[model samples]
Target: MYGDVDVPAAVQRALTGFLDLQQERLEAIGPELTEQVQAARDATSGGKRLRPAFCYWGFRAAGGDPAQPILTAAASLEMLHVSALVHDDVMDSSDTRRGAPAAHRRFEALQRARSEVSGVGGDPVGFGVGAAILLGDLCLIWADEMLHTSGFDAAALARASKFFDAVRVEVTAGQYLDLVAQASGVSDMDQALRVLRYKSATYTVERPLHIGAALAGGDRRLIEALSAYGLPVGEAFQLRDDLLGVFGDPALTGKPAGDDLREGKRTVLVAYAVDHASEVQLAEFDRLFGRPDLDDDEIQLLREILQDSRAVRACEDLITERTEDALDALDRAPLADDTARKALADLAIAATSRQL
Candidate 1:
């Protein structure tokens, strides 16, 4: 009851219980699936549970009472999130997630070791990618199953299904947009911001809140209010993530320093730097911006180019602006629970200012 609505541990317990049951089902299939099940577990375990927290608080703000049913429903979002992370890492070819090998990489390693021991020949990369995609698909399936079976009555499930469906579609669309942006090799601010809005903003915060509000029978006005508050906050949160990807410490961020720099992500931060860079700075930027083999010094040089261009400052400004917009909308929202409103306000600050 974290002060009124959200309970992180309860969310974790709900997810753990579900995963345990699924693990049993997987193990019964064959011993070869043992590693796969563990990988799935690792993908889902440990996070701030921010989406669940937001959804739970959204329910409270809509005048719903604290109940166990909401926890299971909210925890299902974590499964969906795991699906996103697994697929995103595969797409990015990211080696690590939360300081561990990303799911595809883990799968690749497992298959590689098995093939060597068995003297069986297979494409390790293909095996890893295929397995990771299956893992993501399983998680996606479980997310819907967990939500529908969450002890909510039929009406509540029906009410929330629209938003739930929307989240899935919006996030996938956002991922596609992001992929296209990368392929186009353009760093226009508008394109970057558009991708951020869909990829992170809507699905990460706004839709989950909508799902919760719908479950609680919140009116259309409240849903509108949540959208006003959630979308900007979500954008700010991802903006902070963009900064962390470039400038954060590996220890705190749970990835290599400048992970995005190595990936050559055409984030708004990169766009800003490109826009403001001097000819000499642009020369250096062009030379070292996207090389996957960026050494420590090269990353530092890239950092210098961004900082010198005031791109970091530009991103900081955007985060501050969007967060303020979210808070203002929250203040004006007609929430029944003062406590939930306060919790969300604090969350906005912590989320944008977070080091991880």
Candidate 2:
């Protein structure tokens, strides 16, 4: 979508350089660890690179130099994102990511192959999950290493680290909250929105921009402007994602249709459905929404209920409102670079309007 964008390319190059150096370091440690390093490489592959773009543009809009250090720092966000995704796939028991085998699934396949050759029986599932967890941990560690060693001045790095650290803490907390929300099966829209704010909104948009602004030595005013813009935009982004998880084409979304329904996510859409559904619709919904074995007919029924309740339309309306708010915030902010402002506007559209 952003074929003309130079910043995503710069971010990708920085990521590649860092991962290549990491692979070399692992090779020096021992050839036995080669496959794990390769798994790390695979897990980091093929994303929209949105977090890095947010960071890059935030810095640029603040009159920060488009230099290697800032680019490297921006790319570090991708590493952190990868870490979250790897662990997320594991936690969600997802089989695929980026239209390929997830990290844990790949490790499972490797373990199975080894066992077949050795004629031994073992818990491939346990081994795979363990390896994937360690790989995710390594990605987080490398993210910190990349930012600290990006050649930014110590003061800038220190300042940026606060946002970065908070991102880690908040996202982790949000993940735990999500697990609890799922287990408890809460249906309140406000409660669901709180999960969205921490699990996705902050880490996805707010903190990346905050980290960039801090690195640029931006004032409190600029940071506040960015928060105003980022929070709503990020919420819209995740709202779009929730819609896609249920209704998106697998070819476009890189996941099965109705995946979110199967997972029993207590999203705002589900909450709205519960509030507006008829008794019969609610009964059917309770039976089908979380069924791991949901068939196409069952999935279609749930989709119909969501539509009948106008939950889908409500979610769409919220997305539009949030997006407009983000643009309004952007317009009011005293951004130094017109190009950066335009880029951010384009990003807001792309983030909310994407099919994938």
The clash tally of candidate 1 reads 0
Worst 10 residues of 2 by lDDT: 1-10
Tens-digit lDDT track for model 2 on 177-219?
8888788865788788988999999999999999998999888
Candidate 2 wrongly placed segments (more than 4 Å): 1-5
Q: lDDT, candidate 1, residue 67?
A: 57
Model 2 — TM-score against the truth? 0.97
Off by over 4 Å in 1: 1-6
Q: lDDT tens digits, residues 133-227, model 1?
A: 99999999999999999999899999999999999999999999889888887688998998899999998889989998889999999999999
Clashing pairs in 2: none
